[model samples]
Target chain A: MRRFSAYEWVRTAVTIGIALALGYLVLVFTVDDPNGAFKWFLWGPLSRMRRIVELIDYTIPLIFAGLAVSIVFQAEIFNIGAEGQLFMGAVGATFAALYFPQIPVIHVILVAAFAMLVGGAWASIPAYMKAKWNASELVSSLMMNYVAFFLGLYFINYHMRDLKAGYLVSYKFPETAWLPRILKRYNLHAGVFIAVGFVFLVWFFLYRTRFGYEIRMMGFNKNFAMFSGIKVNNVVLYAQIVSGMVAGLAGAVELMGLYKRFVWQVSPGYGFDGIIVALLARNNPLLVLPAAFLVGYFRTGAYVMSRMTGIAPEIVTTLQAVIILLITAEAFLEFWKRRKIIREAMKAEGGDVQ
Target chain B: MNEIARSILSAEFVYSVIRVSTPLIFAVMGALLSEIAGVINIALEGMMLMAAFWGVIVSAFTGSAWLGMLAGLASAVLLALALAYFHLNLRTNLILAGIALNLFASGATVFLLYLISGDKGSSASIKSYVLPRVDIPLLKDIPFFGDALSGHHILTYLAFAAVVFVQYLIYRTPLGLRLRAVGENPEAAESVGISVRRVRYIALVLSGLMAGFGGVFLSMGYVSWFARDMTSGRGFIALAAQALGGKTAIGGMLGAMLFGLAEALSYTFQAIRIPSEFTNMMPFVFTLIALAVYARSVIARHRKAPSSSQPLEENTET
Candidate 1:
């Protein structure tokens, strides 16, 4: 309920402002033409219609990733298994596309359900460990990611390798499985609608549902929730499984909507980006849209900047790091802000009743 | 098949295990110190990255491996100070701060690399000075021991020595006593006039120094150049090793060795024509299985000994 306090908003804004300023300083010291490069980074993505479309297309997957992270983060479990879960989800989608070439509209739904199950199954590995043994899910989940990656690679190399392609890529998805394109030249697909629909769905589920309340209560205080008759283990397990399904859905949509075939050599790194997105959104599903939009803007602008300037686009990573550090730093400007607030309150109550 | 079996049993395999473990050992020492002092530093990866990048660049310019090593340590120490300032002073979440630092280090290293060398992948153009290898006279003359223990990077010897050094520092010294006291009961330690923040800062700094050595070794000893994400997941693995060791310095070293053995086995598997992907996943799978088993046994023990579980519950509460 106090999620959007005025003080918190002030701190968040200041954090982002400082991060951007420092990012410009980095560019100024590195590049020969700093102002020119800055201009390109700030406005390049919005300059052309095609780049804008690309940004929208890119944001669709990011929204799902952010929502994925937001759900589990709300449950107080730090799970980086989304990366691995995404890989499995994509693998499941590929299996569906290659094998189930019969149904028309139903094939898309089948692929999604299968991908969701695969992703949930992958995430349950770390969840089961944490629930059963009190193991730190952070390390186990990260380790599980590598296992998923290698297993996925094994599948691609041995099971689904198309020899005619001359690369480690799987067979193409049937036409029936394709999400109808919104534009002929651009990549605007129905996945955008799906991504937006999920934002609302997650919002409703997290706030309006009994299970969600239990998950949040457990996250707030495990001992308190356990005393209140909540099943702590089940909440922990289901939260992560639900989060993985969102991430898995993102993987499926991104792969089918963008690429002609499944050719990911490594985890697409959307999982890590999702952490940044969730942090930016303050773990609010409703805020995921704008948070993901901002990241998509940065990624697109960075690509354009890298092409025009010699500077690497990894500058955005540094920028986001500063943002995270300052945003989460509780005492960063707290003393000053508190003093000013007290001053205002006293001034307004000079002739106060005791 | 016979040749594969023979190669796996050779002294070279043992040598490779120690060689590969050098970085992890250094990192585990750092992880153990921070963890023992009640600070969770997941930024070892970032510290290593900054150190490795600075080590290579400074050595190339200064022509002294020692100076390069100092520069590396200094950079890591600086990073440690920032983390301490953010977490201890600013009240930032320790884990989140560590994650940010990792991203910062990864991005900043690449950004700086481009500025310095006009390249984004590696600092290969820099003629970085590699630290000299050390060979003890007596050990070098021995048959199997010579092959397995001699002629390693100087930092490799330092890593083993560091294990003993940290073991003594943690269990024998007055400072170590204060550190443990603060970690166990910060309020009680503060009542006794111990500064919890100061002790934690020192712990972070020392761990940074240890992690710095690991990073420096990566660039200046194991290889002659800095590459992107070269430390990979070794930093996280070090944290796992520390936890597995029951948070003791010696136990942490043994845990690191187990992981190192797994890594060495993976490398050997590649020689026998196994799918590299399958073999590459072995260490991670081993870590997961090992961690789960360890966690389960610890839980079972706590259930059996109800009195002992109090401290653990208190540990979780904080």
Candidate 2:
């Protein structure tokens, strides 16, 4: 693990300070009770046991999405088709749940397997283009996300929408297809165990496997990898496929675990949220858990704060952007800090000479 | 088939096509400039969204349309500079930084909108001014052509005029040469005393300014209100349009019009029971296909080159 230096400490503190100040200013200008809103935002999530459970529940999909993103980060390719793949993953699970009624755990497994397949297939669109033509994965993934979004909407509104449900929603999953909640209150699904298992599983695959070595090599330097006799194109394809599966699995697990019916008129943004999680973890699958929890905590607090105080939760997004900017900034405040250090060092040497 | 022909063959359809494409043409031009300068401005969407929000707010508050337009352009240029600062100086990945800025605009716009109007969706509560239209003396007299071209939104006219202006600036100037040289071969340009960073900064700022006009048009001229996510992926579409045009102003305008026509088709066809969702997905799907085809051609051309060693982008796929 990389230890945090003083520079890193200051970087994080400063990033947080800037984000909070911006968020606080928004609150000051709008809400009559800014401090009260801030207090609720900071402490409201932990005020109730139910909220804590929901927060943990919410973190589950983030782990899967983070792992998915981190896997692609291994290849130095920004293939964010996970958003689309997740949408298709849920659709895949819906197909399985709606059609293939089976015995206890087998039904869930069947649904999950189909979801993974769909997700991987969705990711293949961008992966194939990138490998075959060197097309911009960034652009392809972005365009594909909108395609997936509208496709999902069409599927729900046309194929699976319950006509008698009074709104756009799907038929309820059979009890056998449910993810088997671990807690009676809020949400404690078996997906939590799966999430933890995958974290360690990804950690092992990335560090102990030859494929992982190839991915890391390609990411660090593509030409070097090519010179080292690595098949760059194949690695990109395989890495994206696996990553897509994980993202797709996340969508399925979230659907089966959380609600009785599919009511997502707009696609859930867990896929994009995964980018932040992976970034915070520095693209390390092992560290994604903590990063996912951190994001989930803020999201939970936002939800609680909004629920109680009527302040919009969109403020966290601005904070997220600020953090991303600071985190990715290689030379942020570097020159000034280094110059100060050099001056102090020279002064110390002069004192010693005297 | 008959209905489709009737709907599309009208003068009204032509007007709507130009109307729908006005923002896209401006945006595609911006994307073209940035691409030519070797920087793909992915945050065009965010910048547009910011401009749209600011234009509406400033116009509503100050009661001056011109000031609103300036505010819109200023906000967008500022964001562009921020992206340039992070990508060029701070060493952040361009794609990530762009995405982050897009998110920032998406969030901050809504945050500000909610704060100002106590509504998170649209800024309709505030009464905003819209720019005036011009009727060309002879053009307006030419029946069908006049109905299609004359008395359109002020920005709509500026959009087409801006294309001609950009085409001239790109093909006839020293700055254009510097921009192209920097994009084509940064090290060579740097060695030749051309500051690659400065050229790119200029390109990005210009890109910002052009996109800002497109954004302000959306809020002030298209409709006198700002809506959340109103740009609706037009920025991404503009990137695709640029790719389709192979990074040229004229070609990009053609591509934008093509997609704008697709958009107009969706709207016209909605009366015939065609789903809007499917129509909405057309441009994005087209963008993906366009990128693939564009990249394939670029790669094929690269293979035929004498020294087939240069990468398409720095640390991108190559």
Candidate 3:
């Protein structure tokens, strides 16, 4: 390994140390057996291959959602509606799966694609409103979250609710349409490969494509981009639509891969989690893969920790929050303080060369 | 149709408007301050959610609605500080910070709820303190509008008062002038010896206080209990109102009233033949239309004023 800089090591050490410390505090305060909580927080998820597989399963959708969000962020459009877009995607995909129980497997794949398109279309409403009306995407997109939510609830409750389930879940999707598993006797599916492939595709598009360069250019300086003859509004709108579609695909894949039916009335905070994943990755679409996996690992660990030690799973979320806050603020503060320290040290040394 | 029209004018519809408008009144007031200072606060949703969750939790623990309200405000203020610190001090992206905070708020609250109650969905397990209605005896005797408007949670009166207070703060004070100057042109304001950061920080904190009250009112005054994500989408609606209001206090109030009216009408029309889903969507649909209309106006204004690039880009498109 290359020799590490002091600041680099400090940041790494601080991030990991703070995460453990916060997790321990929560466990000690909240759990009946603090030691057990600590042990569980550290190693409970790794105790079983099954649990590791579950984490990977969770990461699949999150990775897609993260890519969706990062795409919009790259274009400098703050699309907060990913969660709503994801839900709409689920709704679209679920309906397709439900309505076409007789269709061949190949046609089922086409239907899933169509569902993602619907998600993009749903997300595009706010995108267009944002581009054309000067409406706040943060607000309009957020409002769409509720609209999508209640709309889903309405469908589950009225249009597609499964009576046998005794809860507000949709009717079972055809087994033929289920996403095929990639591994033997594991919950992990082909979705993981698809999600990984997408990350690479996004990386290529962002770094190698002319349109991607223009999008980044616009995000950096809208005036400069406009001056250089990039179609700023069109790029923004299209980015949002694509982002929404990606999020929607995440939902479709998630429903097909896991649940036999659509049951969620609201998100389990997946869309919102995508935002954090994107942020932690610094809005790089390809990096979102690892970011999403890390988040998924923590979420699974948190759930496991909750069960093992009777601590709330929320402590995991708190730890995540603190981590993101620290990371986002980390480099800037270090840069400023380091600059000051170096200035003082140079003055003391009479400006001698190293 | 005639009978429906008659029922629409009934007192129950009017009361529904008042009830729905209560939290929104505080939300609009909160959003107005932030918009004036040019801080786009998506965290209002998260703030209100935290406040509502903690308001009920504290009230259940302490058995005092007053304490709950105080807790609500405290929670929101802390969140406000985080947003302000990140946006101003670290000079991070405001919207990204907002998204992070909102997710933290939602997940953190739910996690805490499960810890406290062993339940994930609602806070009904706690016997929280609920705010008492203030029956203004003399005002109740004044007839017609008096009794209809008088006996409400004290926050209702405070919300209306905040409208006037925020208006004065925006228009009548030197601080307000400096705040507006900072929001309109940060570089120009900096040239004149004003700290853009300080103005934004103040606006965010004040916005926090307003949203905090909105949270308190939801748990302590209106519903007397908190549910998971109870503030729902009201904060976003308030943001919409800020846009629809043209960033003016009066415009905000008017926009809030219109949204409030849509929400109230949805409840009323729920009894009618209209599908509840479609009716429930009216407020948001109207907000979308309002935003489109607002955009059209901004484009029109840009066409009229060819010299102004700032207004065309920042205020008109967000």
Candidate 4:
């Protein structure tokens, strides 16, 4: 494991502090009740047990989504189709749930398997193109996202739509298909345990296994990995498929855990939010849980704050963008780091002017 | 079936195709310039969205379409410069920065819309100026072609004019050569005393300017108002068009037209029994197929001449 220096920690804290300050400043200018907005923004999620449970529920899928993106990113494949993959996953799970309404344990297993299959299949298209033609996975994945979204919409609107609901939503799953809620009063479900389990599993897969080592090697230097007989194309393909499976499972989990029916708008930018979560965690699987929880807390707080103060919930989105921009900036603390290095070197060379 | 055929053949449908394609043409042209300059301006969506909002808001306030266009252009250019700064100077990951900017634009535009017009869905509460349409004097006399070609928004005409201008600027100008040089071989260009960063910045700014026109047209001409996420996925389609066109201005225009044709057909199909979702999926599916075919052809051509080196090989790196 690599150790983070004090300077690194300070810089991260300072950057986050600056981002929060800027967000608060925007709130003060736009919101009528700045103090209340700020208060909710900081602590609303923690204010009530129910809200805290909702935050945990929200974080469950986010953890999986983050892990999905992180896995593909580690293999240096820019797959932005996680959103589409998740949509497909939901579609697959919905089909399984609606069709096999009996045999509770078997039904849940089949739903998850179908979700993984659909998501992995959706992702393989771009992965195949990248492996064979060296076509950009980014563009292909993005294009596939729209395709998946529309396909999912078509399935729901034409096949599964519940006419009695007065909205474009799917028929409700049988009670046997629903994942049990962990907390009786709150929204918390068994999916949170699965999410935590996967975090450790992914960490093990990415670090302890030979395939994981090869993925890391390929990401570090594709040419070197190729020369070292790592079968770069296969690795890329597998990494993408695995990533898609995780994203698909996230979608399935979200559906089973929270909704009785497959809602038309299944994703509220969960895939994109995963990107931010992964980046915040420095693409470390172990860090994804906490990072996702942090985002979940902020998102819940934003919802509470907006509801109370009439401020748009999009304020959280703006804050997220600002934070991402600041954190990704390579030049943010380079000068300070360089100065520190120089100072240390000078101290080592004291009284030895040659 | 006869009615469908008649509608498809009518000049009105052709005119609609051109009108729908106008914004895409501008965006594809922008994508072409930036891609050639080695900077993938995926933030085209964000820039266009910001421009669309600002253009409508400014026109509503000023009652001048021209001023609104300028405001839109300025706003897009500002965003482009910021993208260049973060990607080039600050050394941020370009794709991540673009995505961040897009998220920022998506949220900020709606926030600003709510703040100003008190409506998050659209700027329809404000009476925005609509861009004027121009009919070619002599061209209007031509029977079949006249109806299809004349009486378009001035920006639509400018979009076509931009195709030629971009073609000339890229292939015939010294700046174009330098930009291409900087993109193709930055080390060689630097050794020859070219400022790589400066060229990239200029390309990005020009790209932003073109995309700005597209955005202004979306609000001021296409619909006369700004809606949340109005540009939709046109920006991504433009990028796909750039890819399909082989990063050339004329090719990009043709690609944009093809996608526009698909979009126009989707609209037509909506009137028929086809589900709107399938129709909506057409352009993206078309893009994927186009890209796949383009990639396959290039690969085939390379295989055909295995030993011979091609000058254009470098352009295919993207």
Q: Which scores better on DockQ, 3 or 4?
A: 4
- The residue pairs that clash in candidate 3, if any, are A134-B317
- Candidate 1, residues B134-168, lDDT tens digits: the string is 99999899998899999999999999999999999
DockQ for every model, please.
0.68, 0.69, 0.49, 0.58
For each candidate in the order shown, give its overall lDDT on alpha carbons: 0.87, 0.86, 0.80, 0.86
The pairs that clash in candidate 4 are none
Whole-structure CA lDDT of model 3: 0.80
Question: Judged by TM-score relative to the true structure, which candidate is superior, 2 or 4?
Answer: 4
Q: Could you arrange the candidates by DockQ from highest to lowest?
A: 2, 1, 4, 3
Superior by TM-score: candidate 3 or candidate 4: 4
Candidate 4: tens digits of C-alpha lDDT, residues A1-354: 224466656666776788689878987788677888899889988889988887898899889999999898888777888889999999988988899656877787788888999999999998988777767777788899899999889998899988999887899988887889887778888888889999999999999998888888898888999999899989989899989999999888888889867985634688888888887877789989988998888788888887777777877777788777777787878888899999999987985775
TM-score (chain A) of candidate 3? 0.89
Lowest lDDT 10-residue stretch of candidate 3 chain A = A1-10
Two-chain complex of model 2, DockQ on C-alpha atoms against the true structure:
0.69
Identify the runs in model 4 with alpha carbons over 4 angstroms from their true place: A1-8, A346-354, B306-318
TM-score against native, each model: 0.96, 0.94, 0.92, 0.96
How displaced is residue B9 in candidate 2, in Å?
Answer: 2.6
What clash count does candidate 4 reach? 0
Instruction: Flag clash pairs in model 2.
Output: A182-A188
Over 4 Å off in model 2, which ranges? Answer: A1-10, A333-354, B306-318
